[model samples]
Target: MTSAFIHLKASRLGRMAAACLAALALAVPAHAEKLPRLVLAGPAAAVSVPLIHMVETGALKEVADSVEFVTWKDPDQLRVLALGGKADFLAMPSNVAANLYNRGQPLKLLNISTWGVLWMVSRDKNLKTLADFRGKEIAMPFRADMPDIVFGLLAERLGMDPKKDFALRYVASPLDAMQLLITRRVDHALLAEPAVSMALRKTKSFPISVVAPDLYRSVDLQQEWGRLFKREARLPQAGITVLGKAMSNDALQAKVMAAYEKSLAWCQKNARQCGEMVAKRIDLLSPEAVADSLAASPLRHVSAAAAREELTFFFQQMLAKNPALVGGKLPDAGFYGNAGRP
Candidate 1:
């Protein structure tokens, strides 16, 4: 009877061990099946239309288990989100990213979202070029924004002190800038796409030039940077990025690139529809403004190679101006995604 009882106890122990192993095997695969959550940070304005398109069209949703968008009225808020790691994905200016990265912020640029959509609109014909704005009042969105920064750089390049040569009126938003320009409250205003287009449309009486208008124009910001540095530095605009802490998995990175590509394609194919969606969401203008803005803005398509080249040029320029833009060190190969060489 003792031998039989011992045999039964040994058999029960063996069965329990096998069941535990099987349970672990099942749980491991279940955990692996879980998807990472993606969060994109940007403003609700036209600058982030592409990102909004990606979410609305389900491109990001198809890759990640969940995706969330955080909107900020100010660009500083977006920068704070990236710095705090509260955002997995973010759309921000290249200069802002460079400043943050230089400050030891761990984030990798994914792709360029838009470029060259800024316009210097002014009613005063005397303000034809950057050099003409001496002791003049200009309305701008915020001091931290790329447009403002670019204007500052332009002023510096033209031998004008940013603090004393020109006076800047900080408008609460892009819309406010447009209003200030239309009502002639401000001498000149720096405007971005859709807002620029909307201002032109609303004030049919005013004529606005496209700033440099030509790629080789003397006042071209990119060309000026290149001339100063004697390097092929292009203006780095806006882009999508991922926090380094959130990009631990190689597979997640690949999915992000794929989603951005898909989203870009979707926006290009449905440009009109996307514009209509934006029009409805912002409640600012007619569908025509949406369509015209997308048509006129050169941010519709970006090849992977072109995007990298643009970023590389931007970094080179920033380094020339201030080496501390990239954390007192230049970005190595790790700062970019593995799509292709720029």
Candidate 2:
């Protein structure tokens, strides 16, 4: 009877050990499953390089399970990717987001990545201001881009129609715009940082002047927008966005917002380091250019209040300009998310 009792006790112990191992195996997978997967669309300009760094340097990995940085050659390509449900998050102009959202596409703005970084570079010594742009051919990227929109607004404020007052030459890229300016094919070109800096560096014969670096500030577009609408109109530039259909869980939405806040904080703290990391990733820019771009670029943290206010303003502008852009149905309070809510 004692021997029988001993054998039973041994069997019980073995069973307990097996149970513990099984529990551990189950727990491991549960932990892994909780991690989030994100696909980010990068901007065409070099400023987007830091976002690539945030992923490569493991800054974003701390918050997300994995991040895939996809480079878009142009705005239209980025829009196509967003529409196909291939991309989870995209950094694009607010207007583009409005266009998508209006078309029944479920996209919400999460944060603003950039503001106004456009520069009107001119080879002429006499072209000192926007007033000098009259009757001059300006090389622009395209008719629908952020630069085009901003320049159009600037022209309107100056009492000139962009299509009629100035000869707008369409260029494929900033480099192409620079080439046009250098060869004297265009009187002026809309250029952004690094490219603007690069163009000036390459052309030693013709000195290029920044007709406007703080163009938004100079023209009072924000104020004008507010005055016209009696509501705040912040320039909707670049930001993080996600598809409404894919975001089903409230818990997941909370996690994404938390991640954005954390990422923005990380970027602000390590600006210089992030710049270096981006330079290495793109392999096109020099370390010095990267550092300067990072310093000059308006990379800032967007508060929840600011994000809400800015998005609302952008949506209102779109509604006024073209309600069809938002499907003729205005965005409800839910559109702003918790960040924008009072």
Q: Which residue pairs come into collision in candidate 2?
A: 102-325, 102-326, 102-327
* TM-score quality measure for candidate 1: 0.74
* Candidate 2 accuracy as lDDT: 0.61
The segments of candidate 2 whose C-alpha lies over 4 angstroms from its true place after superposition are 1-30, 34-37, 62-66, 125-128, 182-184, 201-234, 244-246, 249-273, 303-305, 322-330, 338-342
Clash number for candidate 2 = 3
TM-score of 2: 0.73
Q: What digit string (tens of lDDT, one per residue) describes model 2 on residues 1-342?
A: 999999999999999999999999999876764558767666645436545765675654644588777877576787788888877666676667666776777767655656545677775665555667788888887555666776776566567788898888987666577667656566578776555655554454323333322111122334444454465443556666667454564455555555555654564567567556655655444455555555555555463246656666665655564465445655554444443122
Highest lDDT: give the candidate number: 1
TM-score of each: 0.74, 0.73
What lDDT does candidate 1 reach at residue 255? 64
Q: Encode model 1's per-residue lDDT on 38-62: one tens digit a residue.
A: 7777754454676667677766665
Pairs that collide, model 1: 102-327
For each candidate, the alpha-carbon lDDT, in order, equals: 0.65, 0.61
